[model samples]
Target: MSGTSEGPTPATDLSRPSVTQSDTTMCPSTEPAATAVARQAVAAAPPAPPRSGPGGPLPAAALTPMAQSAPTPVGFTGLAQRPPAAVPEPPLPEPPFRSAFSAAPLAMAVVDRDGLVVSANDTFGTLFGGGPEEFAGQPAADLVDLTSDARTRHAYHEVLRGGRARLRCARRLKHPDGHGLWVQITVAPLAPESPDVLLSVADISARRELQSRLRHLRNHDPVTRLPNRTLFFERLSAALEAESYERGGSGRIGLCYLDLDGFKAVNDTLGHRTGDRLLAAVAERLTRCADEAGHGRTSAPLVARLGGDEFALLVEDSTGTEQLAELAESVLTALQAPFEISGRRLSVSASIGVVERHAAGTSATALMQAADTTLYWAKADGKARWTLFDPERNARRMTRQALVSSLRAAVERGEFALEYQPLVGMDDGRLRGVEALVRWRHPQFGTLTPNRFIALAEEDGSIVPLGRWILATACRQARRWQLDHPDEPPIFVSVNVAVRQVWDSDLVADVAEVLAETGLAPHLLQLELTESAVMGSAGRPLQALRALSDMGVHIAIDDFGTGYSNLAYLSRLPVSALKLDGSFVRGFQHEERGGTAGRPSPADEVIVEAMVQLAHRLGLTVTAECVETCDQASRLRRIGCDTGQGWLYSRPVSPDRISELLGDRC
Candidate 1:
C-alpha cells in the first residue's frame, strides 16, 4: 500500500494491475463479450499458493527477505526478489530396455557401482552357462578373468565408479568345457541415477589363431623350414638389447654366418626344386650342429636361413671364440655329406664366417656387418672351410674399402700423375718412345703404384674417368715435350688402358677431345693393353681399337704370351706392336756357370725369335720389356726386335727427366 492520504483508490495506479469488479463494470461499451467473461472469472478465482522448496512450503516473505524486514518507503516501488526456477524433469527411458537387453543376441552384463554384477543377459548366461540370475553378486571383472592382473582389476573398478568413461581389454581363458577361449571385454558406463556399467564379451579365438599362424608364416623360411631373415634380426636385436642391460652374465654373443659355395650352379644344373631340397637338408644338418655346440650351455644356438644360399647360427652368452669355431667346424663337416635330391646326388660345401665378441656395446647392424665381411673372407680364403674374424685383416679390408670410396674423388682432385719410361731402339741404343705410367699420390700413404688401386677402380667402373684423365694428361705432357725440344723427333708417349674403359665410356671421343685440346698428333700416342684384354674380346673393344687405329693411335698388346696368344687373331685386330712380357727377359738374368752370367736358355731365345719373326711378317713392331743389360739388348736386336723398354734406359721418370733425355738426344 502507498503512503497516500486517506487511502483513496487510484484508477491509474500501475502498482495494482489486477482487474477489479468496478473497473470491469466501467469498461468501454464496445469491449468484446469474451474479455468481460475472462475478467469476471479471473476476479472470481483466488491466487495460486506460494511455491516451496523440497523440504517444506515457502511463504511470500521467505522468498523476498527485504520485504520481510523493511518498513514501507514512499515512491520507492519495485517487485520483490523472485524464487529460483524449478528444475526440469528428466527424460523418459526409451522403450522396455531391460526386456530388450535380457533377450539381446550380444553377451552382456550389468555391473553395479561397487564393481559387482547386477544382471546378465540370456546370451551371456548361455555363453558361460549357469543362467542370468546366478551371475549376480559376482565380481564383474571375474567374468572375463580380469582379476588375475591387479592393474586391470583396478582399471575395471575405476570404470564402474564412472571415473573412466570406458575400458576394453582381451584375455585368453579356459572355459568350463576344457577349451581355450580368447575373449575381448569392453566396459561402458551407463546413464542412470544409480551409476552402473555395461560389460560386453566377444569370442576372439578364431582371430587369435589366425594371427598366430600369420606370425609363424612370416617369421619362417618356406624352403628350409627355418627362421627367416626377419625373425633372425628380431632375435638378434632382442639379444643385444638384453646384453646391453646385463645382470651378472657373460655379455657375449657369437654368430656363424655361412654361404653355400657354388649353389647357383646347382640351381642352374638341377633346377630350383632340387636346390630347395638340398637347402632343407642343409638346414637340418646345421640345426644338429648347433645343438651339438649348445651342449652344457644355457640353450642351443638359433639356426636360421637368411636368404638364398645363406644361413646363420646365433649363439647367445658365448663362452669364447673357441665355441663359435667349434660350431663352424661342425657345420663344415656336416655339410660335407652328400645329399640325394630329385634322384641326383649332390655334394655341397659351406664357407662360414665366425665372429664372437662382447655384446654390451654392439648392435644387430654392426654384428651382421662384421659377420658379412668375415663370410666374404672365408669365401676368398677358399670354400669348404670356416675362418674366424681377425681385426688386423678386417682393418686392411676396411682400408681397401675406403680407397674404393675415395677413388673417383681422388681422380677429380688431380691426385694422379704420370711417369715416363724410355723405350729405346735396340740396335743404336737410342731413345725411341716413352711409356706413360700412372701413379697415385695418396695424401695418407704417400705415392702408390698402379697395382694397389687399379683393380679396385676397374671393378667399380671408376677406371673410365681415371683413364680419360690419364689420356688427357699424357697427351698434354707429350705436346709440351714437343714444344720443349723443337729439334727432337717429338717422341711418342705410350699409355696403358684397361679393357673396361672401352666399353664403360666413350674412349674414342675422349681421346679425340684430348688430342684436339693438346694439339698433339694422334700418332704420338700409343695405347697398351694386357694380352687377355685384347686377344679374345671382339665387340666394343674391337670397334674402339679399329676406330682409334684409323685415327692414327697405336694399340700395342702388352704382357704378351702370358694369355691366350692367339696369334691367328692378331692379324685381324688393329694392333701396331707387341711388348714381350718381363718373365721372358728375366730368363736372361738367370745365371748358368755359377760365377759368370750366361745367355738365356735356347727355349727363351727361340720363343723370342719366333714371336719377333711372326710380328715382323704381320707388319707389327715388337718391343722387349725389362731389359737391364747390353747383352739383353743385343740379344733382342739379333731377334729382330724393333725397340726395347727396360731399366737399361732408366726407370720411370718425371716429365722434366724426359725433357732432359730428349735434350741430350737432340
Candidate 2:
C-alpha cells in the first residue's frame, strides 16, 4: 500500500517495509539511491569555511579523501564509521615564579647567601632611591651608609649564616637626600628551598624619640629634675657591694641625711612653687659635692631628693672618719649660702646626720635609721650642724627610752619609795628637818637613784604625777613621826619640786591637800626649789608659790649659789632658807690647817661666811649641803650656818630606817 497521491501522497502511508521472523542472520534491505545522494551531498559541498585566515583555501581534491573515508555498511550500506577515542591534554605548567618581596609593607629585599641583593621590593627600591632593576644583583650593604656602625654588619652576617632566623639591627641607610635615615632592619630566612635572606627595614625616628623621653623620666626626679631616691640607692648599693667584694670587707659606706632646719617656714611663707625652685638650687649644690668627691673616678656618689626638703647622699669607700667629717663639713658649707627663690633671697641651714658603716653587716634600712637618729640628735643639740653616729650614745638612748616607757606605771605599781636625809642644826647637833628624796625599787633594775630617772621623768612630763605622790607620802610620814616623837623638837619635811611639777600642775593645791589630809602643819612641810626653777616660773607658777607660802608652807631655795644668784629677787620671794651648794661646803675642812686632809679652803670659809651674813641680813636661815665630816661640820657651824645636810648626819634612808633613827633619838 505504497501509492503516492498527486499532492505528495499521504505522508504516513508513503512506504511500509516488513521482515519475517528468523531473519537475524540477514541484513536489512536499504534504498541505494538514498545512500548515494547523502554521499554526493557531503562530497559535493564546497569545503567548510576556513577555521583561520589563510593565504589559500582548501582544494576539491581534499573533499575526495573525506568521501573515500566513509565506509559502506552491508545491511544498510549507509552507516558512518565511529571516530577513534580522544587523548586527554596534559595540565599546563604553573606560571613562572614571581618574588613576594615587592608586596611586603616593610621595605623588603632578598639577599643571596653572599649578601648580594638578588631582588628588592618596591619599598626597598623607593627607600634607596633606586628601582628594582638598579638594586637587583647588587650588594645590599652598598646602599647602607658607610658611617653606619660595624655592629649592624655583624648582625646581618649572623642572620645570613642561619645562626639566627631573624635579627634586628639599627643602621643608617643612604638616601637620595643629603642626610641619611635611621632605620631598624630585620633580616629573616626566606624559604627552606633557597639560601636567600629577607630583610625588612622601618624608619624608627619616632620610636627613638619616645625611648629618649622614657629614659629621661626614669633617671630624673619629676619635681626637681635631679636624680631621685631610687637611682641614688641603686648607685649606693652597687658601690658598697663592689667595695665589700674588692677589699675583702674593709671599705666603709658613709651616708648623710639632711633636712633643712626651717624649710617648712619658707614653704608656708612663700608658696610651694617657690619652695620647689629653692629645692632645685639645693640639689645643684649637693650634686657639686658629689662631683668634687669623685674627682677623676668614673663612679661618683649620687645625691638625690628623698622628698620634700630632705635629701640624701651616698659616699662610697670613704678613707676614714676624716673623709666623712670632711664631707659633712662640705655639706654644711654648701648649705650656708642663701637661696634666691621667686626674687627673694632666703637664708636656710641644714641639720645633717652622718652614718658610716661597713657593708659587712649593714643593711640599707639599718644605715638609714642610724642616719635618721643622728639627724634628730643634731637637731636637738641645736640646729645648723651635723652629728656622727655613736653606738654608745644609741645604747644610752635605748635605755632612756625603756625607762620612759616604764615610768608612767611606776607610781601606781608601788615601785617608787621615798628616802629622807636629815638636815641637822650645826651648833646643837639636833635634828632640824629632813629632805625627802624619791627612789625607785625597780623589779628588774633593782634600786634606781633620783639622778638616774628624774631627768627622764621631767623630759616625758611624768614628773607632775610622780611629784604629787612624793609630796603626799612625805607629808604623811612627817606627821606620823611627829606623833611618835612628841618630846623632840618638831622637824620639817622638805620635798624637792621639779620645774615640770611647778609649771604643768597646780602644785600649790596638791601640797595644801596633802598637808590637810595628813594633818601635818604647814610649817613642818617645807618645799625645796632650785633657784633656776623658781626664776623660770611664769604667772601661774608665781601664784602657786605665793599661795603655798601664805599657807605657812616654808619655801627654801635649794642649790642656791650654783644658779642665777638674784638675791635681790630672792628677798622678794617667799623662800625661808638658802641651801648652799654642796660643792662649796665639801671644801670646809681645808680652812684651819691651811688645807687639812679634808678641810674647807680659806676661800671656801670666806664664801660661806658671806652667804650666811647675806642670808641673816635678809631674815633667811642658811643650810650647807654635803657636810661629810666632823671637821666639815665644825667649819660650817663656825661660819654661822644654821643647818647642815650630809653623810655626817646620815645618808638618805628608807622609811623603816628613818623610824629607827627617830626611835633612837627619842
Candidate 3:
C-alpha cells in the first residue's frame, strides 16, 4: 500500500478523538509531515510481532508460526522505517437493513402478512416485557388485543397488504404480565416491494388520563358529581334542536325547572357544610328520578344542578305535556321523602315548572325563562306542587312587565293624563264631585285605563312614584278648574289610592305636598282607598290615614262591602264616605222583556237601604257606584245615598270635557 493510502488518517484514525483531547492515550493528536511520512510507511508494511525489546521487530523466536492478519500501532517504537508501499482498496459490503430498526427509541417491529412478528427491536421487547427472540413467530395481534377491536384488525391487514402507506390508532393493549396499557400504534408497509409490515407504538396512557380528568371536571359539579349548568344548558340546547318521531314530526322538547322550597332557611340555620351534604343528597335523588323517567328511551333525560338549590332536567324527546307533568309530579313525590343528612332527617319539598312544546322556534333562553316564571306560579299557588306553563297567563305577565318598564319612564316623561267622572248628588241632581281617573297615553297602546296597569304598578312597587305623580297632577288640575270656573261650586277631585301605596309610600306627606303646591283645599282633594286596604291598615298605614284625615283631607272607603267588612273598624277609621262596590249597585235593575223600565230588585233595594242607613248612622256619606239608567238613579236616590257616580252622569271624560259638563251643571 502507498504511504498516503495506508496512512493513519484511515488505519489509525486517532486524530479526532471520541473523548476530550486531554485523554490522548486512547487517541493521539495530529503529527508533523516528517512523522506522518514515517508513520504512514510503517503502517503500509505487513504486521510485525509484538515487540519484546525497544523499537525493533520482535525476536525471531517470539514471531514463531503466528502471522498477523492486520497491522497494529506502536507508540515511539524508534525503529528505522521501510520505504512506502502501494495499497489496494478493499471491496465495500452491502448496508445492513436491521441497523436502524434495532437502534430506534420507540417500540418497533417487522411483521409478516399474517401479523406474525419476524423481528423486533430491544425497545419493543422491553416495552412489552419480552425479548426479540421470544416475540419472533408470535402473532402481533395477541400482544395488542386485536380481538377487542375490529378497526385495528382491518388497519393491520391493510398495511401488511401494501394497500395503505401508513396507519395509526390509539388503543389499550394487553401486556404479558396481565395489565392493560394505553398506546398509540402505527402500521406501515416495511418497503415498497417488501411483504412485511412495520409497526410502531408510543405510550400515551398519561396523556389520555389527563384529558379524561379535564373533561370530567369540566362537565361535572365538584360537590355533587352531577352535570353542571354549562353541560345542562348544552344538553338542553341540543335537545331543543333535536328531532322527534312522535306525531310524525320534528322539534319537541320538555324541561322541568326545580327549586327547593325554603332552601335558604336551611342554609341559614345549618352551616354551609351541612348544606353541601344536603345538596349532594338531593342531586342523587333527582338523578334517580331522571333515569327512571327515561328508562327504555333512546334519548334519556339529563338532570343537572343549575347552581344553588335549583336543578333542571331536559327531556330530549318528550311525548306531550302530560308526560312532562308526570315527570314533574314524580320529582315532587321523590322529594316528599325526608333526606337523612348529617344524622338529621330533614323534610323538604320542591316546586317544579314544566314546559313542553315544539322546539322549532323556541330558544334555550326563552324556554328557561318560561320555566322560571311558571315555577314562581307553582310557588305562589302554594308550594309542594308543579305548574304547567300557560301561554295566556305568561303573555299577561309579560305584558304587565312591559307596562311596568314603561310606567317607570312614563312618570319621568309625564305621559299620564287624568280624566274625570262626575259624582252626581242623588237628591239635588247636581254635579257634586268627580273621581280623578288616571290614564296612560301610551306611545304604543294609546290610552290605557287604570285597570290595565294599576295592579301591575302596585305589585312592582312602582306605585309609590306613580301614585305621587297622580296626586300632584290631580290636585293641580282641580285647582285649575276651580280657578277657571269661579261661578261654579268648588268640586272635589277624588283620587284612588292602592293598598301598596298606603304601606309603601308616605301618603300623608305626598297628599300634603300636593295640596300645598296646588293651593287646593285638602277637603276638596278626596283620597279613596279600597275597603280592603283601609280595613287591613294598621301601624304606619293606619297612622298615615289618620294623619291625612286630621288635615281635613276627605278619606273615602271605595269598593265597600266587597272586602272583609269589619263593622267595628268602620266606626274607628277616619272615613268620610262609603262607595258601594259596583257589584252591589248592578243588582238594582232586572231588565224586563219589554223595553219599559222595571222596578229595582227587592233584595238589592234592601241591601242598599241597609248600607246607606248604616253609613248615615256612622255620620258618613254613601255614594252608589254604577248607576247606568234613570231607574237605577231613582232607586239610589230613594235609598238615601248621598251621591251616585256612574255612566249615568258620564263615562270618564277628559278634563276639557268635564269643564263642559261643569258649565252646564254648576
lDDT of 2 by residue, 200-289 (tens): 567765665566678668867987787777777777667656555485444778888999988998889898888888888988888888
State model 2's lDDT.
Answer: 0.71
lDDT against the true structure, per candidate, is 0.77, 0.71, 0.75
Which runs of model 2 end up more than 4 angstroms from their true locations? 1-219, 234-251, 260-278, 296-298, 333-350, 379-385, 442-446, 483-490, 536-538, 587-601, 663-666
Model 3 per-residue lDDT tens digits across residues 1-666 = 112321221111112211111111111122223322232222323433333322333332121111223333323433222333355233222122234445556677767788877556678898889775567767887776554456656656766676755555556666678876677665655434446666667776676677667867998898889999999888777666535333454457899999999888888998888889989999888888888988887656788988999999888767899889888888888898998888989888999999998887889999999999999999999989999999999998987778988878888898988888999898888888999888899998788998999988888888899889888988999999999999999999999988788787778888888899899998898989988888878898889888988999999999999898888998889999999999878876764345457654567778889989999999999998998888788878887999998888899988888788884642
Model 1, position 160: C-alpha lDDT score = 67
Quick one: ranking by lDDT, best first?
A: 1, 3, 2
Q: In angstroms, how far off is 353's CA in candidate 2?
A: 2.5
Write the residue-wise lDDT of candidate 1 on 614-666 in tens digits: 99999999999998888888888888999988887899999888887874431
Which regions of candidate 3 fall more than 4 Å away from where they truly are? 1-121, 125-181, 184-201, 222-224, 242-250, 262-288, 337-346, 459-461, 499-513, 516-519, 536-551, 567-573, 589-604, 663-666
When 1 and 2 are scored with lDDT, the better candidate is: 1
Q: Largest lDDT belongs to which candidate?
A: 1
**Per-prediction TM-score to the true structure, in the order listed:** 0.69, 0.65, 0.69
TM-score for predicted model 1 compared with the true structure = 0.69
Residue 438 C-alpha lDDT in model 3: 87
